[model samples]
Target: MKKVKHLFLLFALLFSSLLAPVGALTDNSTGASSATSTSQSSVAAIKKRGKIVIGTAADYPPYEFSVKENGVSKRVGIDIDLGKQLAKDLGVKAEFKVMNFDSLLVALETHKVDVVIAAMSPTPERAKSVDFSQVYYGDNQDIVINKADQAKYKTLKDFDGRVIGAQNGSEQYDLAKQQMKGAKLKRLDRVNNLIIALQSHKVDGVVMDSTRAKAFVANNDQLKAINPHFKTSGQQGTAVAVAKDSPGLVAATNQTIAKFKKNNTFDRVYIPRAGKYMSQRARQNTVWNYFVLGVGNTLLITIFAVFFGFLLGLLFALLRWSKNLLFHSIAVAYIEFIRGTPMMVQVMFVYFGIGELIQDIPAVVAGIIAISINSGAYVAEIIRSGVQAVNHGQTEAARSLGMSKQETMRYIIMPQALRNIWPALGNEFITLLKDSSIVSVIGVAELMYQTQLIQSATYKGALPLFIAMVIYFILTFTLTRLLNYGKRKLNRS
Candidate 1:
């Protein structure tokens, strides 16, 4: 029985894994070869519709970007030009959905887009899911390093035991680990973060693309790429992709790439189109490149500031609760003054006041400090109120039981105070979450920055903003509920 159950569990896991790919496959079964077939049988019908929506990972350089010249945020890249020509050849409208690179095929499977022209390199795992067009661009991978290290570095071997940076969840990083023997690799959350680490000399070098490296050097004066490049670069090859089972679209895409290459039409089409963006290579490798990263930086700063402020608040609350008349009066006045004043002014004052003394202190951190101070004031008040709310009898009981006032407060009063104030603490957390979003004014990214990016691109004013608002609502709502549930569970115990 145990053996049968074990076999059942193993089969279930295997079936679940295969189910994702199977669901993504399409079939037009009514036609011939109904017994066993792959590819959409209605390729002819899709062509007749006169539109082919292509999904692309727009983060690649000289490949796709937003340009002021284009007068719109529609993806502009090498693939954009190729897609335009491909659509022209097919006698259909070429549209694009700029999205996360990893999810490109899942989009195709879901019919969210028709094809992928992003710089998708065909790997074995990918080959199983998507049929590939013949290689369009021969692949080129290059290393970027500080200009001072340029002469010493040639092959990746020179960086052996040295920290080299690469973007996480990317082929570039995978290639570096597998191929750059003896080099120590640092994986970063985003490509831009890798650049940040390199610029800060936290990492000795970064492995990326040649074009992007050039772009990074041009944009940032502080960083320069080591010339002569990485030794491991192979054929600058990549291909277009369609759902693997759909052999018709694959055939059509291959025909399109071949026709484009034969006449050199693809190169001509790609160049003028890519030239519109003022080179994204530098920014792509830097931490500030994506709005999402910007949001995270802001949130990190807010968290840091809140943590420090909480410490300060605890100290103030202790002093306020002290029997000393001067300390109590000072605490009361400080609380009253902070609560009465606007928070923005307080943030600006701290930022401008001691900023000169703190060289290299990030503006984000300074803003966080200000926010933490503001949050601490409220925390102090909450703590004081909770302490005062505890029954006088509890303290007296502890004292009668042979405990000192300090011991009684620690063992008896404080715990009850905390239990009573859990609701208030949860409220404080929610307020902090919302208030943190406002730090974007000081150039903190957070949710508001992401929303602004969408608004900047689409100018569809409310739609994108509304979407961000909904995301924030969901996040905050979920956090509040979780905190409340935790408090309830603790109280029950």
Candidate 2:
């Protein structure tokens, strides 16, 4: 259940790598709106692509969150419905891409996603980077504090010197800095993390947008929002952000929002969808459902990573053993570099760093590639050690039987080497399963990721986490026994 966090070290590396990497507008205002004719090419591009990709952060309930309705995890929220409607209006299929809120704007800017509909408030600063549609939902900001501390936080002055939490890169974070004056700010990547800090007493309070505040507080009875709220200069309404100069997409989105508003769609469709989940929370028994989904994905990724890793490892091992100096040197350098650096660094570099050359690589694919690459480096060493352990007499015997060097290695050396390393490779497979959790940082929704979400939503931190621990133990413990059984059989053969 434990993961080597090295949080401070990983964060330092991440911050340096993520700086000024990729490249939004005020709510409703488009930073001098463009004509539809001027943006038709962008609109035409979407139709040609066949799907409208909308990016979102799904941990914010009522606005966006994951839930299991029929033993299947699904992302549902008002913004999801809005994205679907916008896609329908544009006559294209809607495809949702989930990521951290901090990545949404950058994703749009990098063309990794067509638009962002994560209940984002278009701000003047963001307006410079991306274009926004008209407001779909209007909301204010509030500070969430522990219910026990409700009386202690009656006024903004009372919060002076207290640590307040906010979602990094969000309007709430900016508002907290502008309005909270003397309070110390702790910026996090998600609203869920902010709530966790508030509940765990890490932060004295959390400033949140009204919709998310209500959803979070309702689910967490120990939490309460401050009355009279922190003020904003104007409406901090939610809007869809598209690439800069994308007036055609913006025009299509605004049309959908206008139609939805004309028919009171929020009250009719969006509000009710949120209410269903809120009620489900009262009788929630979906822990196993989330775990199952997470485990399936975990195993899928681990298996693929291991399979590809084996092939790559074998290739590198053979290369390292080759007489050719260049091939040996290339293999040596690759193995040492990958094995020496942190896996987290490799994961982030693939996801964010690779954006310089390519765009829109799926997070899951990036995760698989990262883990496989990391595993390949170690597997190469394992194969090399196993090959060297093979008796030299066996190769000589194969060669004496009229076999060439390649045939001798393949028929005589390879089998024995694999037999020697079978147990070691089994252990590597198990380690890869656990290491897959690292992909959660990029929002893969593996077991650890889903467990963290359940912890945030249920607020019964220990229970959900305990359940996750048991599930993980069952999985790993069973797999270990199976591997041992296979090892015994291999030894017998």
Using TM-score as the measure, the top candidate is: 2
Model 2 CA deviation exceeding 4 Å by range: 1-41, 70-72, 174-189, 218-221, 227-235, 261-269, 348-363, 389-403, 442-445, 490-493
All candidates' lDDT scores?
A: 0.63, 0.78
Predicted model with the maximum lDDT? 2
Q: What local lDDT score does residue 371 receive in model 1, on the 0 to 100 scale?
A: 70
Candidate 2, residues 176-236: lDDT per residue as tens digits? 8898889999998777777777888999998877777787677668989875467666447
RMSD of each: 18.2, 7.7
Writing each residue's lDDT as its tens digit, candidate 1 over 1-493 gives: 5423432333233223323343333332133323222323236645767688787755555655443332223467678878887788888888776544555665554444668887766766667666777888765677778777777788767888889887665567777888777888898534555665676688988877666666556656666665434444433457887754667777888888888788786457565446435343222222223346544664575466556656757777987989999888767766777788777666544433333223223335546666776777888988888999998998888999999978998889888888887788778777776777655543344676555544333323456556666766876788788888888887986
What is the TM-score of each predicted model, taking all chains together? 0.50, 0.80
Error of 1 at 121 (Å): 1.5
Model 1 TM-score? 0.50
